[model samples]
Target chain A: MSVDKTTVAKIARLARINVPDERLEPLAAELNGILNWIAELDEVNTDNVEPLASVTGHALPMRDDVVTDGNRLDDVLSNVPEGASGFFVVPKVVE
Target chain B: MSDLLGLNAVAARDALDKKAISAVELATAYLGAAEATAGLNNYVALTADHALAMAAESDKRIASGEAGLLEGLPIGVKDLFCTKGVSSTACSNILKGFVPPYESTVTANLWAAGGVMLGKLNCDEFAMGSGNETSAYGPAINPWQGKDKVDLVPGGSSGGSASAVAARSALLATGTDTGGSIRQPAAFCGVVGLKPTYGRCSRWGIVAFASSLDQAGPFTRTVADNALMMTAMASHDAKDSTSTQTPLQDLIGAVGDGVKGMKIGVPKEYVMDGMDNEVVTLWEQGQAWLRDAGAELIDVSLPHTKYALPAYYIIAPAEASSNLARYDGVRYGMRVDAETLDGMYEATRAAGFGDEVQRRIMIGTYVLSAGYYDAYYLKAQKVRRLIKADFDAAFQTVDALLTPATPSAAFPVGRKIDDPVTNFLNDVFTVPANLAGLPGISVPGGVTSDGLPLGLQVLGRPFDEASLYRVAGVLEQAAGFTMTPARMAGGAA
Candidate 1:
């Protein structure tokens, strides 16, 4: 199940990371090494076993539905790359 | 008074209580020492004014006799933690100029406990790399040089934290362990590093690495200091749903309980052919030490032990890729404006993330992609369950499991193989604890022939950090690891 240049490139795009054409070959090889190692998980029989998404030993604590926090308009926008008028500025998406 | 630098957090706290050293004096000494050790590249920011002001407040609290547990104790904050108004980059170019507006729950807790901020320390970008090399600011050089005097790597991504604590730049340093980030660096730097149970500490403010595996802990010069710092760090918070409502244990109080009549397991699976000879020796020495401390050593096996690392790779990256999606150019960090929204995300992320981070993101995208989801992501999670089951079976018979912290000691910066899989092998022994959601600690046990420190690890049942620290105390005592790095801050012993 080794990934090739095409697979690497596709995933790179899907991952939103820009990888150049020449770099794709080397990345495929490196990714292959990691994937090949991870393929070892196939040796274990996980049949009928539930996937453990988290290791938290207890149930998620339920809380009453309430807006316990808010109103810090500036704080949310504090780290925006570019912002004005209390809104995040981004490249236009809607045609 | 100059010996204020020599005191560990516990002793320093005692001195402050006795009025032998004022909080201001201690902060001043640590701040000066932090400046002196700038060459180690441990600190990304030195909050001297913050420290002094906090120390001044601590002095007033002392005057009122309302001192907190870590009152006046200086600590180094990992750059991964969001310190309000201070930049928390996680040592990545993507977040190069980003200053978080809110304080992380862990750092906020430390400050609330009267722990003074020394500064934000360096770390692997988003806590991804095994060594500090992946950091954009450059690796934090290990304070300990080999016989040849070549600068070594303080293990990552908590390398800066380990280096600072070992160098005495800070009495204690906060480190987040997603995998072996905390323990590996602690082992390499000859200090105590502990990764508490998964939900033991709040993750509200620390930068997310692998959400499931990430646990906040401490790096300190002594086991007791680790206990003191851990007590201050863990808490239940509404901000982090994963934060535990389980009551916090008396960690510092449990440090000296000793391992008498305790059952410590020695897992044979940890022994491997390619492992360093000195690391093997140290594990054996640790077993002998625990036995000498009245512990009954029993042989145990977590049959799934060998598969832990491979499983970790899938799960960690899968989660990382998802978590890092938040770094799109629009919100924060280094932005490379592109013609379109998707184009902007691609360009900014590509330019912002390092080679290692990009690779992980790519792999994660591959594994979790539509068709490969079950074959990779789900399979890995099942394997994780088996790994936890193995630990459960072992813990049923033994109170805690002991193993080597890292496969080897610190290597010269760049001496380790750069390829991803080979480098991931460095964490062979430490990652299982993270996977199991259990408590694990690294105690500096011995030095390699090259004079680099190696550590022995103790993994305990979930929420049972007390047992883990108890065995660490025994190993720490038996090892008597007093050898200081060639270069240390504060001229500390």
Candidate 2:
């Protein structure tokens, strides 16, 4: 129901966002307002209701198993942050 | 010809068909005007060469008698919609250099129908904010200004499209609504916007937000224009799994059908405590006009209305947190060439994302976190179903529902920015339709007491866009308020 400084710090870490100590108070209040708004949902009796992910009752339709999107490799990698020899270059984790 | 910005898509299409103006000429005029007022930040990228080429092809097709209804028409594609070979950022730095290898189904469909693309319009970063100020590209200026010269914000995340249409920069524009992005901005800028049924348009290649609720629709100057653009944009796409297989309706045919004998439902619950007086007054006036024109105004109940805003906050952010996780430095976009993987992701995301975007991502991550999933995300989904059920039950009694799009007119840019909850609450009235996957539209009702535009939404059953357009057409005619931004010389306010 309420977001404390500790929870704020925890959430910030999980979300990979930086919130200075001074900003935590305001952030906590903001998070509380959202939580308070969300709390209103408790008033309803959803006792037997099914949770909905998609409003349309249909299942996620599957496409052909074949890979059709292979030719645009150059365009796809055009904006890649870092790459060498057609593979994305990242920090050597194993090394 | 210069006044063509006021023309709806149908009228513009008609003008093009009669050879009154070529598509290239029409697009050129808007392109010229948009470039002339480049300071508004309405465009992230303008495909002048692409648009001209497409226009020429449209002319050739028309000459060959192969023209479709939208042939040779110019449209502003929202930056959120993936444009092949064009920059699509959703106005966020995180996606700074990202361009989709393929076009989004919606964009492709528009092109297939012979619609010319003017370019990608600006939007809130990842469509995160109610005001356009959250865009990393810079906030789009509301082309219309108040007398004191305050810079008015064209509402977000479709702010650029709304502002561009208002400024006569494009004949028509596309907008996405996860919440009220399209309609709210349309209202603030005094344009017409329609968010069709959630599955009405395909989402393939659209940068994801809340996949369940997000939908792409149109922003235009008139109700009929919206109808035309909607028809052109709406279709079943095999690539987008959620796209409806249901047949698309003839929106233009539904226009003249009017609101006669229709049961217009006004839910009492949407009249929330502490609503702005102008919105309340205008909503009543809009109802009266409908009743006078033969619509039977009836009280309908969406008893779960109070739950909607909260439910939306939980669901949207929970989904957003997961969807945005793909934006790590490993993929395309602004990346910090860090010494390590952990360092890379942290530095990339921290530097790339804007404040509001980061805040949302944080909230989203927290809600969907391991210990809190059931209490937040899953519980919200259950409430989401209940909200949909409320609309389903209400529709059994009323033909369509009407409500204020927002509790008030557009506030000053920073008015609610610091207050995230208040900002999220702005989507309260509009979120139910998204939750329910219903077709909804925001029509210009009247101006607020402060002279800002007023918007009221008409909501229809799933895949029932025809019914939505008829009611919108009725209200649009009765309101008789046509807004244009060229009237405001310097884009002040």
Candidate 3:
């Protein structure tokens, strides 16, 4: 159950977390401990158990589709670190 | 002046009704106290101007005979809840400078209930830690220091609210409980905290951790005060798809009903190893008192209790990793200046979140990763169902379940910092309720012989807060929880 540097980097990227190369070993160890802890759940005889997605058994009752949302686009964009016009500015992708 | 700092909600409400003190006056007094304790780092941000303005409006409403139960009371809103046009950072750098244009439904509900917001309190980065130490702002001091010690660590994610209430900085405060964030800290800080049924309050606009387990409740110095805040906070919000449609009842009156003839279930499985002796003793004493008070104590078995902690570790992080994925640099949240978008995301998240938050996120990502999902996340979900079945079976015979909030009283700062497993285990007894989405309340049990506070938690069936209140109120009355951290910290000096 060892998390190598490559795997650690990939997981970090997927999680959007930045892990310094120096801290990777310690981070991996901590993650290993957690994974080991989680491995205990495997010993349980859960063959008959159903997956509990939510505490309440009720399904999420969604509303009818509607075109409504917060009308404060300018207000929202005001907090953006980088913005142009009314859209969030980001690095060019296709270009 | 009746020591308004320690007065319960009933007394505070009566004071406002009698015009003995105006909402503005109470808000000012609390604001002053909070400002004085700013060194403790209990609050990430304070809106003194907004508080005073709201208080003034509340006073006007009182003058016009339009007061509600929470009217004129100043409360601390946990920083995790998005405050419209205000900083709702969740005590993390990732969301720095991000002001949500819309208020969290719960926040809007509080304001609608006429409660005045004093400020946003500090919390663990995205509500991820057991001790407030994980907060990016810095850990909040317990404010209960004696001659021999430095200030203590207020327990986590809700630590700021607990510290603020304990320090008398606010009359009441809101807290979100995913695991034991509210109850564990309330016990450590000697305050009352309630984590109502999972969907009891709307999670809309709240910075999500584990959506299935996350719930917003209240923290206050008294059980009645906790009820006041909880009632105001719990509502059927159509916006939150999972919000319960259960009619909010007057839990204050239910508390007066007492626990006579109630079947109080003490589950055998929750008596975990490594629990402190004093907590065990206090739990026994609490049970004895409940039994003497005409309540029947039943020994129930929740066989899958051991699986809860591990299941939660898998499930909470799994959900957290997903919920937090939305906080990429392209959004309004903090973004690091980098050469590329991927680099920007990495830099921003690395610079933004605290260590513990990062650990959880990484763990969450790993568990939910492609190959491991079946072995970890999916299996944990199945175990989660078993854990719920354990409670469901226990509740069939008993009206409510009771357990100690934490294994021990408030530990010194840095006690469990190095050992993340021990810190995670601190929520062993409390996490089951969250996993099962059951409502739970933590009341002051008794102080240890060493003088630290002890807490007992009562878990109830879904949407059955009335039973939880009845049982908790009985224990609260028997416990006679009069010692606030301020009393220990020395009053107003």
Candidate 4:
């Protein structure tokens, strides 16, 4: 259950977070400590138990495929750090 | 004038109704009190102008005989709930300066009911920490102090709500419980916190952190105030697919209904080893009080209770990882610019999120990673089912289950900040109800030897918050726990 620095780095990258090299070691140790504590779950017998995904017990309520709310482009772009004419401005992803 | 801050929501509402005080006057008192106690760090943003505007509107409504249920009662909103046009960060750097264009359904409901907004109260960053220490603005100090005047942490991630309510800065405050966020802090601060059934309150605009477990409730000094707040906050919404369609029950009426002849279950599993001696003693006293009030106490066993914490840690983090992926630097909040989009995202998240939040995201990503999904995520989900089943079985025999709200009274601020596992364990007693989607409440039960507050928790069947209010009312009446924090009393002096 021990997590090494390499695994921590991998997880951090997967999560889209950057871990400075100096922090990676300490972060790995902390993660390992938590994961080790979580290992106690191995003792429980969960055979045939269905995974409980949603606690509400209701089917996800569906709405008709019609425009219900979101046509206000100004509201959508209001919080954008960088925006243009009805579009978010991100660093160019393609050349 | 300062005494107006001491009034509970029920009393305050009555005064506003009778014209004994104007909405503007009440709002001014609370706003002034909040400003006076700014050292507690209870609020992240004080919406004084908004409060005055809302109060003036409420005054007009009262004049026209159109007063709402909570007309003119000033309250604190947890920073996690989005306030339209007002800064609504989840007390994390990631959401710095993020003013949500849309309001959360719960807050919208409150405003519709004529509740005035005092401010956005501070919380643990993204509701991640048990102590408020993880908040980017710094921890909200518990109004209660320990020996030698050491400042204690108001248990969190709803620490600010609890502290403000306890300190009399706000008559009532909104709190969302994912794990023990509401109940734990309420217990620590000797206030009442109710975590309604999952989906009882819509999660439309509250910043998501473990969606299935997060539920918005209220913090107040009394069960009746909490009940009133709950009545206002709970509503079905089209936006939240998981929102329940059940009509809001008569929660306020249920408050005074004593627990007579009701079957209360004492879960044998909750009396764990190494628990605080005062907490154990207070729990026993609470059981005795319920018995005295004509409730039949039955001993029940929830064998899977011990696994709830570990299972919750896995499931919650996994959900958080997925939900937080929406916060990539492109659209909102702080963005660290770089040569590429991926680099920008990495830099922004690394700089924006705090240590605890980053840790959770890492754990979540690790658990849901391709090779480990079945072992960690799926296995935790199965344990979650077992936990729910245990509650279902217990509820079949008894109307509600009673347990200690938290392991101990408020501890020193820095006692367990560095230890994530220890801090995570603070939610051990409260997480099971969240995992099972049952309604739970924490009511002031007693005080520690040093005069700190402790609480007793009641967990009820799904959508059965009325029964919890009834049992909690009996406990509230019996405990008669009236010790206020030294800081709050002295401040009034």
Candidate 5:
């Protein structure tokens, strides 16, 4: 149940977070500590138990496809770090 | 009138309705109290102008004979809920300077009910930590100073709310409980906190932590006030998919309806090994009080109680990892630019998130990762079912279950900051209720020998918070626990 530097790196990548080389080992140790403790869940017998994804056992209410609320361009862009012409500016994906 | 800040929500509401006090007068008193207690770091932002404006409106309504349910009562809001045009950061650096243009459904409802906003209260960064130490603004100091003026933590991630309510800076404060965030802090700060059943309050506009388990609640000085705030805060909304269609019950009226002949369960498994003696005594006293109030006490078993924390840690982090993914630099909040989009995301997240938040995100990513999904996330979900089943079975015979709200009384700040696992264990008593989507309340039971407060929790059937109020009312009457922090009593000028 112990996590190593490689595993920590992979997790960081998957999470889209950056971990400097120096911090990876300590991070791995801390993750391993938590993961190891969590490993104790293996002791429980959950056979035939359906995974409870949500406590509200009913299906989510569906709504009409028509738009109910939106169209506030200024509000949408209020918190954007970089935006112009009602569009967010990000690193170019298609060079 | 200077003591107006000391009144509970119910009393303040009565005064406001009687014209004995104006909403503006109450709001001004609370604003002054909030400023005076700034040393506790309980409030991250104060909306004094907005509060006064709202109070002025409330005063006009009162003059016109149109006061709302909570008209003019000042309350503190946890930073997690978004207030329109107000800085709502969830106490995380990632959301620094982010002002939400929309208001959370809970806050909107509170405002509509005539509740005045004192300010945004501090909390654990993104509600990730139990001790409030992980807050970017710095931990909220519990107003209750232990021996030699040692500043204790106000138990979090609703730490600021608990501190403010306990300090009488705010008559009531909103809190969200994912895994005991509301109840534990209420216990620590010697206030009453109630986490209603999941979907009881709409979550729209609140920062997502662990979507399924996260629930908005209230912290107040009395069960009656808590119930009053709950009535104002809970409402069905179309915005939150999980919001229930169940009609809101008469929660305030349910209070003081003593729990006579009701079956109250004392779960055997809650008597954990090495539990604090004071917590144990308080729990026993709670049962005795219930029995004295004519409630039939029964011994019940929740076999999966021990598995709740592990499963909660896994599921919450997994969901949080997914929910928090939206915080990439391209959108709202802080941004650390880089040459590429991926680089930008990495740098921004690394810089924005605190260590505890990053750890949770990583844990979540690891558990929900492709290779580990079934082994970790799926298994934890199944464990969640068993935990819920445990409650389902117990509720078949009993109206509610009583247990200690936290393992021990409030400890000094930074005592458990270094150890994540040890800190996580503090939620051991509170997490089961969240996992089961049950309504739970923490009422001040009594104090330890050292004068720190302890709390007794009562978990009720889903959407059955009324029974909890009935039972808690009996306990509150019997215990008559009236201990307030020395700092709070003498600090405010």
Candidate 6:
């Protein structure tokens, strides 16, 4: 029910955030505090209780299978941190 | 000289309708007030030119006798709601300089109804924090100060919207409530805020946080103005599949309706162990006011209320992790280069997100992890159902529940900065409403002996926001809270 420094580091890595080594201990402690509090939910007997996957029970609206928006390459790429010729620039991936 | 910024949206609407003051003139006043109160750090961006342009358009419509419901009103948008062409960062660094290409469904509706944009207001980074301190742009300080004259924080996520409205900088402001974001700040700022039913407003174009819990609402100086704003804000957008198809009642007319013969519930469990005595007193006063207004009071129990916070912490973060994963230095926003793609994501997210956001993401990732999924995420969901059922059972007997909006009055800035758990307690009362996906409103209840504002919250049935408004209007009238903060725009005289 509690996390350690290694677990904190692992969680951070899994989350794709780079947490410094020294910060892991403190983060683990913080996470433990929250998790310890969250352990209270385990006391609730969820037997035969349905999980609430959605807040609203309305049926999902169906729409036509047509393009509502497109053809604006500039606008689509407008916010890219780096871009060239309408494609977002990223670090090299393949050799 | 005429103090145009001092007027509330309803008063301004009347003046504009009569042509006593032009839209351009009102927009100019708000633009100046927003600028004058920049020290509060309430706004991330002020759109002066856009305001004037839109105001002129509003004037033209008025000239043609075609003014809409909110014609000539200047409203502030929470940074979470995308305002096209204006820089819309949820007061976070990751999305720094990320100007949304399209308008959010809620704000677009506001604009279509003749509302002018005063600016983009500040909020917690990704709307993640309880106090505005987590905002990368810096916390929006509450305009209300205590006897000690020390600075106080505007409650988070929607702090900017609440503070600006209270300071008379914006007549109305849009706010998103995930975990008490709108209502908490509204309480701290002594303004009115409401989180409508989950699907009452469209989620499209809003920077996603907790998808299931996040609901966009309004911050206004009066309950009537809050009702008016909701009328413009709520709509069934085809773009947002979750947007409700149910037709909305007349929210504006609801403000005038009386709660006569209605049953108001005072949930006995909302009285927590360490809640401020003043807030407890305020709750009692709210009950008395409802009774005087012809509402028969019933004692109700939402036993699962105690478990709502822990469940909310688990579920909100889980959704936030999935939603925020899109910020991997890819499509838009801040990017940090690295030798490899994974390194780049690690660097970009680490550098881009603030402390609170990173913590939430990590917690969210942990809960959704392979070994922990059932124990945390799924268990939380089951608890969520119990929480909703508690409301359902209570609503069967009582029309709505009256509770304190926040646990305490606005505390000094950075008071609980190091203690995130303590900060989370601030939303304890308000979070239950979100978990249940019901409508809730925060009306100015009274003030602490030190003159800080407090808010009384009323929770109503699903899609029955009209009841909340009617209850809130009655509570507001009884509270007779007519004082503004001493540290408002242009400095309260």
DockQ of each: 0.86, 0.67, 0.77, 0.89, 0.88, 0.85
Candidate 3 chain B, run of 10 with poorest lDDT: B484-493
Which residues of candidate 5, in runs, are more than 4 Å off? B489-493
What are the per-residue Cα lDDT tens digits for candidate 6 across B1-493?
3878777788888889888899999999888888888899999999999999999999999999999989999999999988889899888899999988889999999999999998999999999977788999988989999999888999988989999999989999999999899999999999999999999999999999999999999999998999888999999898888889889998889897878999999898997878899999989998999899999999999999999999999999999999999999988999999999999999999999998899999999999999999999999999999999999999999998999998899988877455577888999999988888988999999999899999999999999999999999999999999998986875667
Candidate 1 per-residue lDDT, tens place, B397-418, comes to 9999999999988988878474
Candidate 3 per-residue C-alpha lDDT over B465-488 given as tens digits, one digit per residue, 9 for 90 to 100:
888888888888888877655432
Chain A only: list TM-scores of all candidates. 0.91, 0.80, 0.82, 0.92, 0.93, 0.93
**Order the candidates by DockQ, highest first — what do you get?**
4, 5, 1, 6, 3, 2
With candidate 2 superimposed using the best TM-score fit, by how many Å does residue A35's alpha carbon deviate from the native? Answer: 2.5
* Alpha-carbon TM-score of each model against the true structure: 0.98, 0.95, 0.97, 0.98, 0.99, 0.99
Using lDDT as the measure, name the better of candidate 2 and candidate 4: 4
Which is the leading candidate under DockQ? Answer: 4
Q: lDDT tens string, model 4, B81-197? A: 999999999999989999998899999999999999999999999999898999998999999886678999999999999999998888889999999899999999999999999
Model 2 C-alpha lDDT per residue in residues B282-396, reported as the tens digit of each score: 8999899899889999998888888888888888888898899888877688887677777777778878888777777878888888878877888888988888888989999
Clashing residue pair totals per candidate (backbone < 3 A): 1, 4, 0, 0, 0, 0
Candidate lDDT (C-alpha), each:
0.91, 0.84, 0.85, 0.92, 0.92, 0.91
lDDT of 5 by residue, B1-493 (tens): 5578678888888888889999999998889888888999999999999999999999999989998888999989999999999999999999999999899999999999999998999999999877788899999988987677789999999999999999888888999999999999999999999999999999999999999999999999999999999999999999999999999888998998999889999999997766798899899999999999999999999999999999998999999999999999886999999989999999999999999999999999999888799889999999999999999999999999999999999989878455588889889999999999999999999999888999999999999999999988998999998778876833542
Please identify model 1 stretches exceeding 4 Å from their true place. B416-418
Residue B116 Cα positional deviation in candidate 6, in Å, after optimal superposition: 0.5
Runs of candidate 3 with Cα error greater than 4 angstroms are: B486-493
Question: In lDDT terms, how accurate is model 6?
Answer: 0.91
Clashing residue pairs in candidate 2 are B145-B492, B150-B493, B151-B493, B152-B493
Query: Which candidate model has the greater lDDT, 1 or 5?
Result: 5
Which portions of model 2 show Cα errors greater than 4 Å? A17-26, B1-6, B486-493
lDDT of 1 at A55: 89
What lDDT does model 4 reach? 0.92
Ten-residue region with minimum lDDT total, candidate 1 chain A: A54-63
